[model samples]
Target: MDTTLVIRAKDVHMEFPVKNGPSVVALERINLEVPKGQLTALIGPDGAGKTTFMRLLCGLLDKTSGELDVLGLDVEAHSQEVQNLLSYMPQKFGLYEDLSVAENMNLYADLHGIPMGERPERFQKLLEMTGLSEFTSRLAGKLSGGMKQKLGLACTLVRSPDLLILDEPTVGVDPLSRRELWAILKHLVHDEHLSVFVSTAYMDEAAMCEKVYIMNHGRFLGQGTPAELSAIASGRCFEVKPLPGVAMRVLQSFLLADSRITDAVPSNGAVRFITTEPNLEIAWLVKQGMTPVPVEERLEDSFMILLKDDEQELAASSLVIFADSETETAVEIEESQVPKSDTDMPQLDYLHLTGQTIADDAPIDIEVENLVKQFGDFTAVANTSFQVRQGEVFGLLGPNGAGKTTTFRMLCGLLPSTSGVLNVAGVNLRHARTQARANIGYVAQKFSLYDTLTVYENLRFFGGAYGLYGDALERRIYEIMDEFGLTDKKDEDTSQLPGGYKQRLSMAAGLIHCPKILFLDEPTSGIDPLARRNFWQQITRLSAQGTTIIITTHFMDEAEYCDRFMIQDKGRLLILGSPADIREQVQLPKADMNEIFIEIVERARDKGAM
Candidate 1:
């Protein structure tokens, strides 16, 4: 037992048995050491056992075989003690929506058995640290996504545990708030001497940590400081100037398909890639008419290259075994057993989504003029106006509570606007909300599928809702399932599917009717890099096939996939343009989307705008 380390795992291996198939290996020969008073990051593609390992540390799941220690205590032998010595915040931190901020903190304090005398000082400090001091009276449900996360963090800190284990803490948060949370963690490490272990989808966040561990296929790929990991691709990275009129995503897709390239992604108005063979090949570049410019590798570049080299992706289903029966039977549950989600859903009937010849004149598909939505005395969205052209991918971006969702809902015709001229697919939204929705497909921020249903059943239900029945609907469902790579898992239980598959299922259902325009709200939020890449490829395909796409995403890299993007802050549209245009507007033409976004938002705040 090393007293200097907060967590130490040696020869850790976790496996779950399936009654009818081979046992699922969640972790294999895992070893780790987290020194006291340091921040450690756990990053991997989806179903690489990140959350599983974190759960083992928190004693939420018992490890199958291994020596696990937390604060010098054997976790398996003293599960309760280990839990009491640390705080574990899962991705979905439980916050009572009906409870006020102060009330939520109090509830957590009660759960952790914090002394009443120590509650006030701790609560006050946490509130101030999270920038939620003035919102103590606000109900948790009323808070923005960022504020809700802050409140969850505050609640977790009520007891001042020795270690903090956070799983994907900034998954769906906006850029600004994500930075804020990291700042808070750094402060805790330096000022309060707290040891932290966290998982995150953002590579930039992992780069900020003192140590990073990359995992794939339930095994470790590499572990080191950001600089050390980045060195893996030191001589293999290059930025290619895209051909004229070629979209960045299209260029990325092309580069990725080549056998010589390990990975290629959108980067600051260019396509960045790593070669399977070392160094730049000038002859190859010449043949393709590409000007190769060598560039330094970031932590993400190393991660993607490593994953590709590993040649494994748990893209379809999670490996975790859910015991129902010895024959691997599923519990009898209907689609109604799951809670309902808000997706206008994909429809193909009203307007053609099937291989239609896109007209040369790309007319506006969505036109929003003077859009305004008021909730009591508060303006959820101001007089906002924007247009999305036919077959284009447009992105809407903002911090939490900045009215991104309000605008999205308006466009989907799920909510009526207080004042605005909204039109979609040539239909006036204000006058024909239902009719407008018929021409659009929607996949919300969260996975909008019935977990209790099978993949095929969920699609069947949604297809029927959209007036697709009999062979036409059935054929469309199969076509979509195959298109999104869900055909093999058509009969699999939806709830048991991996996070990435759920994302695919959501996408497949939304396109069942092949709606002319698709609205995706944070579709790739919590999924891994591999899953995001696949999702974007589908989006790119759809855009090329002439389906207009309007999406909102916090991942700047994903935003780069857009043909044009609109930035909103405090219910006001701040900027709208292509990646190059926005970068130039922010005086950061060479910076990435993340840099440009922060600059634009910060300038807007500094100008004293709400």
Candidate 2:
């Protein structure tokens, strides 16, 4: 690799003072370099300081210590120049919701001082490239989640800068939108020689980058190509399929029990375990009389190993400098002993299946017959038909731009179907929009709650809108607040809560009126693993209470919670079945849901289903 660097940081550190005394280290001794014209990815879990680094590179934030340079210019000394040369897309890039699509683009162009002569050409090209030509008149706030993201990207690309920095650009985007975004990015890098630095949690996206920097705890753990990183865990991973209801928790317990196992993570009904020792055999599994099958090392498995190694290294460093002998002894003692509760303990009801049942002969909660939606010459949803049984968790699975959102809008009475019949809760959505909407609740892909309103206020407003009032509404709101652990934050503004809590509030608001059916569009996107588990618990509880849920998610493992699902591509339905049934239909020897989804989409495309 060439040593010429466009961006460099040496021993950078950033610390923010908390309320009390101690400080929170956002970045510590971070060292990274981005060669000109290469795509460099900063990959890690949430709160790993990827955003902090991006801010530093773009001269948006000052480092507490150390040196930083972009394009041979000091970040602190030449902030204006760096800002001129770098284009940044923050996690929440300011998008004017009130403006039309074209108006927003024009606003960006004027702010950037682009020449009038170049503006028209650039604007036209961008519109054509991003497929936003026809939607120019649409209000930014009215666009779909994926469309909004594309618009954001287009706005940032209006000017040709030396480097482009995107923080979690595809975080909550659907698979199709993700692919489209990547395609645009790849084209820019290849054709325009654009130097791209992006942060992502998706392992597949990381694999496609020219180089990757894996970070944890505000520090870089490793830097390499995807193949090089996976090589670190070669021949050390094993896949285990335990009995029903035991796969995930059992594997988690085993990883906690055995120090030899560097990592254990759940993936589509199985656990992938990685070990560092080359000669380490599966003695632990054999002792427990369980069988283990060797499996290929994926990028996620490699990331897990890297995280574990980093954790151990931190532990060892702490031990070496400990001043108290008791503390060191405690560390050693804890390392040698596994928690008693983890061994042979029964698994919690992770699914949280509540005991509520809808009438077996109840009318279908949602029915779509010959539904179609069109945009000029493009058909988004074409003659799609399905029925969702009452009390069932019906999943809408599809690649990006598969018309899922369009279909969802029609069902919710937010959009008029081009043709066909649609019914929700025994009411035709087209003609009886008010009655249909009253019986259904919807959670959009983005955070749709008021940012300035307190949690309690938001709940109160939503409850009131649903005809909830007086003491009854107050009582229900309090109950929900307690149930979701948001009672303490009831007075805090919705925007002030963390991402997880905000998600909980959104779910709570959707269920405040106890509608017969709920619609969730990618509800768990950008949520952490632990929070995702809790969110699923809530979903299970709702299902048990006889609420029909129609949800769409890109997280394949979540499909296991659905009663049945349909996978769509473009405007066509590809497959419809339960999670297990879909797996079986794929017919791959060891394929999981993610792999199965990939296979089905690819096959559908080959067969012209799109």
Candidate 3:
């Protein structure tokens, strides 16, 4: 073992056995070295064996074959010693909801056998660093999504382990909290000389690390500095904008469907795309009356191109794509057609609507007037108002305790407002709550389905609760199962399914009733890039068929899919506009959604808006 290397793996392979068949290979030929006192990032698409590798390093799972070394010790042979020198934080961080923030930290400190004499100094520093000094006595359950994440990090840092393994620590956190978390990690590396290994799905976070290892199918595809990997697409990236009077959505659709284009995504009133044909010239876009400009490549540009190339290579080799199970197949969907349902329903007619047809004149589907919600002396939301039009995808954004979810619950009829005019689909919720709720579907942030029940059983129960019975319920269940590609796994227990499959099942249950409006809360929080793409494709199809969608998410990039977005802070509405409009309104020329969000929120705070 090299003295400078904190962790090393040589020809490592991991496999799980089946009942009566071949073993499943999760990781193979994994060779890597992490330098001491530096930050290393491990990233991959969903189900790419990221968590498995983390588990192996933490000694929670025994490796089937190969050698693993942590701090110059064999992990398998000295598992107990290895575990004592490191900390691991899983996706769903374990926090005692009933205990106060201070109590939770004290418990972890005791578990690590920290001296009581040094506790005060360490606790003070951590509390100040994580901005939780003011909430020490607050119960963990009362903290917001971002606060709980910060507390979890504090607990893991109690002993100052030699190595820290964090698995998606910022999955459901807001942009501001994420920025703070990264700041803390950077400080630790520079001041304390801590060696950190973290896995994340966000490309921006991965770019900030000193070294990044891209993992797929249990193998490392690329390993280098951020700049080294970004050079992969140095000359192939271009920014294209629509001609005068042409809509950005129209141009985005054309580019995404073009065979020459590898990946096209909407960003700031333009489409950023990479080409399969390296020799394509700028004159081609000019001839088509579109403005094209050369732009600097970012980490995401390289990641998308690399993943697409890998998929094509796998197809040519006749190897199974990702997984051999039917559940992993990418379902191709048509944008022009509505979902074929047995019941009579109207579609949104997206293929036929032009820019003028989708303007503010469209019929209003949701209305909020002077909405206010209070608990004791605390005001969660105050005097907020917004409207969403029919067949539109609307996004609600805010900081962790900025009242985004509270507003969402009121719109879904799960919580009532103190005093306001809350209406959905022309029905006032205060007077006709049942009638208004009957037309909306909801997917909660956390998993809310039955764990022991099979996929089919869960779906059938939800369908029946929505008023379907007998053959109708059965037919609807089968239709949704087929639509989401869940038919073959209907007999599998919901808790045992993969993370991606569980997400699909949750979505299937929400759409069983075919409500006029859909409410989604952080629907794609921790899934891989491919799963997120598939999820948005389904949302686009539903919008084309006239389903109004109101969603709240922490992933800033997903805001590109919203027709309009509203940002709130301290229960006050701050900004509401299109992605392009928000940037232009804030006077930031070429910033992405994440930067724009930070700037707006900071500006508001400096001016006492929060």
Candidate 4:
């Protein structure tokens, strides 16, 4: 290995034993080298062995074979020496809920043995760099999703190490916080010459790194600069707007079903697809009055092609991915039923079996008027007013600890408001809490499920708790299992399932009683792109069937799908409108929702509203 390299790997292999099954190979003969003081990225989906490699480099796990080196020390031979030279931040939250932010930082600094004379200066620098100076006295548990991630990073860097390894540090953070976090990393790399190796699911984040290693199934498919990797998709990437009457999702699903199309997604009222079929002739799409338009390649486009190629090879070799058990059982609607013409685009009855309707004159499902919540003289939500019509998808946006979750709890009947009116399904949540609770469902961000219980048992328990019994409960459980693509994993323990499957089961349990309204708090956080897409597809279908949805997410791109969205900061409603309306209010042309969000939040802060 070159002396200039900060990290090096040679033919590394890692395997884990599975009960009564073949050993799982997390890494296979991997070879890589990272030059000193460079920011590198490992990009892949879930179950791609990214965490395995990180653990190996941190000396937390010994490799089954091959050599691993970090900061010129063999990880296995001199584990302590290597560990002392690097800082590793895992995916989970690493802060103490009971301690204040400043307390947490002081604790980490002391653990690193920083001298008392220098501790104050070091902690101040970290807090300022991470933009957490003002919230030093706030408890860790009250911080927003993104702020927590920033605090985690600050804690990891208590003392400058030779290397910094982060495992998906920005998993569920909002766009504004994400940009700020990356700016911190870029600043450290240039000013202090810090070496960083981070794993991420966001393609945009990977593009910022000097070099990116594309990993899949525990092996490096390719490694190169962002521009060089993007060249692989030249002339092969294109976008096609949906026909006059077609929905973006309808077109996306249609394209994805074709064998030639490797990947497809709905983006900004159009469909972006990657395919080897150069001619781009789809008889079905053509008959439906659509044309594909050529577009420039992106890092994400090339990365998807590589993953799809690897997946095809695995299928050809008869190798199964145990983590994706539900892939084969996913159901797709037929083309004829997917709106071939304007007249054919009828309202999809997703809950026809249960007989739900979304009338044009449907009454408001949720009504919050001048809502206020206070905790010991600290006002969490102040004078908030909103209304959600039946079958509408409403998005709630705000910075961490901005009262978004607080308002969500009040609307769901979990918390009593200190003042003002709150109603759900025509029942005042503060008055008739029982009736309001029965008409709605809730899915927490962390996925609250019985880890030790089988999938069916959890569903049965939830259904029974909802007052269902006998064959009715049995039928509802069966329906949810089949609808959520969980029939194959009926007996699988909740904890053993993958992130996507676990999310599906969580949603199934919530919907077991056919609630008219659903409250989702950061429901799609930390899941891969494919899983997020599937989850939204289910939400779209349900919304069409008269299920009013109230969702809060850090992902700004998802806001475009909602009928209306509201942004709050410091317990005050800052903006409320449709996606386009919000963009127009921000006065930014050609800006995505993320950029719009950043502009709005910054403007609010500038006006002393934050």
Candidate 5:
């Protein structure tokens, strides 16, 4: 291995015993060389051996077979030495809620046995770098999600190790924090010459790395610099504008069902697709009364093409995806049912199941007037007002601690408003909390399922709590199992299921009663692109069925799927409108949601409103 390589691997194979079944292979003959003083990324979906590889590199999980080296030391023999020379930040970094940020930083320093004389300089540098200096006195639990992640990073870097390994560090964080965290990593790599290796589901994050390794089913699918890999998608990528009278999702689902297209997803109000036959596809697009536009190849596009093994079923076309979404079942339509003209496009079999909501006459399902929530002297949500129409996919977005979750909880009937009028499913939340809850299905930020329980048992518990009984509960449980493609995992412990399957089961439990309205809090957080896509497809299907969906997400691109969305900060509404409305308000009508969100939030901060 080259002396400059920070870590090297050869023929790495990892497997875990599965009790009653054969051993499960986590990694297979993996080979990788991470360069020093640079950023390297491992990209993969859940159960793609990413976490397994990370653990092996850290010597936390012994490999079945492989040669692994970290900083020129054998990880197996000098695990302590390797661990001492590097920092590892897992998805869940333990931060003591009772301790302040400064206390947490000191705790890590003590754990690493840093010299007392050196503590001051290291803590100051880390605090300034993570922008947590001002919040040092704040308890870890009091910090927002983004701030907590920053504190965690600061703590991890207390010893200033030569290398840093992060597994999805930015998961569930807002765009602003994500950008800031990357800045810290880039600063460390370029200025301090620290080697940073990370695993992330975000393609944009991977594109920033100097080297990216795409993995799936425990094997390397592809590896290269971002630009080098992006070149693979050249000429295979193109965009098609939605035909008149056709919903973007309708066209996307239609395209996803076609085997001719390799991948198709909604972006910036149009459908971006990959196909081997670009010219033929363009001609086909034109004949469909849509304009085909050539687009630049992106790392994400190439990534999908490489990890085609865990490929989303073409039958699982999604209405929206943070990265990708595919659930098990497909809503089938007869070939003859396909519309012959662009104007007749909106009428489809799926649309019939969820009567097309393009109409403006849909009844208002959620109405909040001057909604306010306060704790002693602090206002978590103040004077926030919004309305969601029947079948509308409404997005609630904010920076960490921005009160979107507070508003969501109010609407879900979990938290009683301190004051103000709140109505859900035509029931005044203040007067009929239980009735409102009965009509609403809520999926919390942290999935509210018992990990020790099997999928079947968890469903039964959630259903029974909702008053489902006997054959009604049994039939609904099986139906939901089939709906989310979880029938095979019914008896499996929830903890043993893959991240994606757990997400499906969580959603199933929420919708067991087929509630009139569904509330999802950061539903797509920490999952892979494939799972995100599948989750959104289900949301899309439900919305089409006249199910009002109220969701909060840190993924800005998902705003496209929402009919309307609201952004709040400092417990106040900063912006409220559709994607177009937001872009127009930010004077970036053509910009994506991330840009719009950053602009709005920063502008609010600048105005001292936040």
Candidate 6:
């Protein structure tokens, strides 16, 4: 009932009937209030009701119970009015592919009824702000992922709505692009006093918000600023640095073996664990007969501690209910009915390479010399050169439109280089495109698999296209399906699969041919962290078997998995070395790869690299 609140929800509940009986609650007793002209972030893992809440706020979905209001209007009763003052950018914004950037802007301007006199200036400013001026004539479909996101943001801002709802706006955007988007958002808030509500999986972005609502399984668990929420673990955290080559899984097991441990999570190079008793301190080093070093808690540690507390409380309540059963005849299920292990599950190995050995003398898998790709007068990639040694995990790291994909496409023979020497498996890809392509595997940035096809059928078609047939194809397909944990869902239509499974299927299809080298173009884009870890495991295993990998990723953590990399900016190579080397060059003490990447890109821009 606060007068300054632009969005107010009270005991909101949304449910959908399922087959057989009970309705699935997508939102349960959710209550929230957003003050005017403030940035509020909704943070959670996948299937956490973030999207459901956003849809409800935009009046795209109706609440099953309770009241919801936005901009002083009832969401359900004054839906039209609410819609007029709110702008929504769904995860998959409906951007027209065939239209040029300028044409797309014009179409949105018309749809929003933007005044003609103000259109030019507004469009020009947006273009300049988003760095899309040069790409105005390019088709929206041809734009890079980050550029497309910026365009979507620009289109949504055309009418200057009072409330902006962005669902995972920066999901796959590069750090530089994300920072730019944040800057523009700050400007909008400061200059126009606009209220912003955005949903994101990135914790870093959540930290930037004035307030954050943490949701899980359609329920609001907590709400507060970053510092306030992080204070939940104020005195209960401990950091442990394991010896070299000590797997996180092993460390996690060691922590969980102790009843005193409340939660454990891997961060950076250490494992942060929280204890049940805040005053309890265990010198793990002393217990293990080793030296100990002082450690500190992080925001992630606090979040995990809170999550674990919720889980334990739920488990305890369930146990009490079972103990109070009315039927005397009912056999006491005891602990047998409960899961023997933690239901929260252990984190998967993001990078796991088995004893699969690489041939020492295998030929250079990929070789590029002075590669140049130009679109009219603009050079997308200029004088780029690199080589992927046999069994190596190579990476192309760059900001949006820094020509990473262009270079990748040229290597894959999807695009002919304007000028330069390129070879894949020692064959000139430009001249022997088909032959070179036959020896390589590729997964594009977007979901490239057919939507209507079932998982099995998609794999079948891709396998056949790669020249696999009969028992060999069938055997390979099943092996891959099992390997990627898609065996049971093979009959399910691909489009019906979750975002993570779709990514897994894409990876399986790409590897069906068992090519000597694999090219992954942002292969983990839009997938959750757990799925990304699984995908990386597959990649690392392939690499260990001498299947060279050329990966492009915006996730800096993923970049750490690469053995060597080339960092590019505006079609020029900025740093080319090992991940450790790049980190060292950045020289930001205690900075992770993401921070280092941001600093490098900004520094380069200031030096006129962009």
Distance (Å) between predicted and true CA of 442, model 4? 1.3
Best by lDDT: 5
Error of 2 at 29 (Å): 5.0
- How far is each candidate from the true structure, as Cα RMSD in Å? 8.7, 7.7, 5.2, 4.4, 3.0, 7.7
Candidate with the larger TM-score of 1 and 6? 1
Tens digits of lDDT, candidate 5, 1-610:
4668889999999989988989989999899998888999999888899988998888898989989998998899999988989899999999998999989988888999999999999899999999998998999999999999999999999987888999999999999999999999999999999999999989999999999999988999899999999998888887886654455665666665455566777777678888755444434456656777888999998887886645554433333122243356633344544443333343444533443435677788999999999999999999998889888889899999899888888899989999999989899999999988889998888988999999999999999999999999999999999888889898989999888888888899999999999999998999877667667767767876678899999999888777788999889899888666677777886677788889999998989954
lDDT of 6 by residue, 1-610 (tens): 4569889999999997867979988899899999999888887655668888899998998899999989988899989899998999999998899999999999999998898999999999889989899999999998877889999999998887889999999877998888888888877777878899988766777778889888877888788988888788777776665544343333543454355776654444455567776746555434443232335555555655555554433223322111011111111122423223344222223112222123346577888889898999999998988777887788899987788888888989899999989999888987899999888888888878998999999999999999999999999999888667688888988876767678778888888998988899988776544345446555655665678899999887676567677889889888887655676777754667788787887888889944
TM-score, cand. 6 vs. native: 0.80
lDDT of 4 by residue, 490-522 (tens): 999998887778888888888999999999999
Q: Using lDDT, rank the candidates from best to worst.
A: 5, 1, 3, 4, 2, 6
TM-score, every prediction:
0.91, 0.73, 0.92, 0.89, 0.94, 0.80
Error of 5 at 370 (Å): 0.8
Q: Against the unseen true structure, what C-alpha lDDT does each candidate score?
A: 0.83, 0.76, 0.82, 0.81, 0.83, 0.75
- Candidate 2 lDDT, 1-610, residue by residue in tens: 2237788889999997867669989899988878898888888655678888888888889999998999889999999999998889988877899999999998988889888899889988888888899999999997766788889988998898888999988876766667778888898899989999998767788889888999877999888888888878888888665444342433444443354666555556565677667546665455444466787776767776776566533233322111111111111112323323324322233212222223458568888899889988989988888888887888898876688888888888899888998989999988889988888888998978999999999999999998999999999999888667688888998875767778878988998998999999889887644345456656655665578999999877677567678998888788897666687788864566667777888898887844
Clashes of 6: 0
Cα shift from native, residue 400, model 1 (Å): 0.6
Q: Whose lDDT is higher: candidate 3's or candidate 4's? A: 3
Measured by C-alpha RMSD in angstroms, how accurate is candidate 3? 5.2
Off by over 4 Å in 5: 282-284, 309-326, 330-335, 338-357
Candidate 1 displacement at residue 139 in angstroms: 0.7
lDDT (C-alpha) at residue 130 in model 6: 90
- Candidate 2 lDDT at 455 equals 98
In the range 48-115, model 3's lDDT, one tens digit per residue, is 89999999998999999998999888999999999999988898888999999999999999999999
Cα RMSD, model 4 = 4.4
Residue clash pairs of candidate 3: 347-545, 348-545, 348-546
